[model samples]
Target: MSAFSKALRTLSAMAIALAIGVAASFTPAHADPNATLDRIKSSGVLKVPVMVGEEPGYVKDPATGNWSGFYMDWANDIAGFLGVKVQPVETTWGNLAADFQANKIDIAFGLNPNPKRGLVVDYLSVPLFTDAWAIVTKKGYEKKTWAELNDPSVRIVVQKGGTMQVVAEAMTPKAQIIPVEDRPLGVMELQANRADVMILAIFDAVQVSKQIDGQIILPKPMLINPATIGVKREDGNEGYENWLTNWINYQRSLGLAQGKLHQTFEKAGIDLSMLPPEFSF
Candidate 1:
């Protein structure tokens, strides 16, 4: 072949190679395991666990089977931003931590971030809500700080497997701790005189106090703790942990946290101001 013809053939081959390179470059990136954002986009839903009860910061309407609470609303907002629906997994306080550890739920709402829990789960950057520990006792029982409740003769009832149990065990090592399946049961134990005091989340204690018809009273002195969403450590894929953390911060910025708390308190017929400030998170 002539030199010009040979050059022309080489040019054509190079042009084809350039086209292939451009096409390859335009191809989508490989899937990332930590890509929680992408997974939400593909799956079109965000699964979250929510407790169903009359707790001031959390509630579920029995009539519609719809959940509405401070944490639930925040979770819904996160799902909305992802253009996905929120699938709420009903859970109880006693089993919420276990469910989160077992990967049964994507996030556990209204949880406190502790070093012990950090061993198993990742906590969001912004807390969903918070509640303080309240010492619930018969009217005029008159115990001040957690230290005051540390007497060996004092029997305190706490919700089994709940954060209060952890706090009680840590703070009042000498006191007798009674663990029950639910907070109301703990309240009942207090009412029955089986327990001297009930250590409970302030919101829960407030709700139980109303139900017991002034049988239980929540005093001012209590320990405060902020609660956040708990995600399984195993789910550290696709920046899912970061996405959730950002999502919670976004809600806090929007003032949705405070608004939802007010709404939840109103629905439960409890005064929002009675809640610890951290509960507004």
Candidate 2:
């Protein structure tokens, strides 16, 4: 071959190699799982966020590190249906919103879907359970209703960055509101008499009442809250949300939630009658 032709051939080969390298570099690092359902199917595990608390209808285990609760069982059932192992990540309500936003957790249990929350994360269609605000106070000081708790001298302890804070501020503008780090701490504040009352979920209030010498009073009118699952708001995860929504709806339709609630309350040694009549799963 001529020297010019030989040089041309070598340059062409080099250009082809560079083009291949560039194409490979442009390729996606990972395939879109398309939904949480597909991702779990691929990974063989469902990652769910279990909020750490002693709330009766949520997560609590008196026994040796065994994770057991109403939401836990419900999550396990979903995992079973998906043919995936259940993996629970202990989280806090204060951080759950941020965690979901960061995609650190796939699903958040016992979440009450709110319009403001919908902007940050996607919620399942089915509400697993419903709870209401309960005012917990020392025995003789039990307020009959939210209105009674709204007195200017009434000090209310509420968890920081939680629904209770929003609810309390809206209902009791005149009352002194103290923000605690978490639900348990807010209950502790009330126990210590640092606050006149604590506004929390009825289930949680009942659980705390069992542990402390307090009276839990459900107002004549309850601030009803519907609890659902929270999933990450990602295009790739939309399918998963839909799958979860459908699956949860199926469970609800079959009255599985009622059984789950009974089991949870029984395990917690809580009498269902103690809860307000309106509270239902």
TM-scores of the models, in the order given: 0.75, 0.80
Best-matching candidate per lDDT: 2
Candidate 1 lDDT tens digits, 1-281: 99999999999999999999999999987766665567666777777776644365556677988776666677777777778888877767666657767756676677775766677777776675556767666666777667777889889888777777898898888999999886557767877989988876666666776665543333445456677777776633538777777766776788766667666677878775654443433
* Candidate 2 structure quality by residue, lDDT tens digits, 86-137: 7777777767768877767778777775566677788777687777778777
Candidate 2: segments with Cα more than 4 A from true spot: 1-33, 57-64, 278-281
> Per-model C-alpha lDDT, please?
0.70, 0.76
| Residue 224 displacement in candidate 2 (angstroms) | 1.5
Deviation in Å, model 2, residue 98 alpha carbon: 1.4
Q: List the residue pairs that clash in candidate 1.
A: 33-237, 33-238, 34-237, 34-238, 34-239, 35-238, 111-228
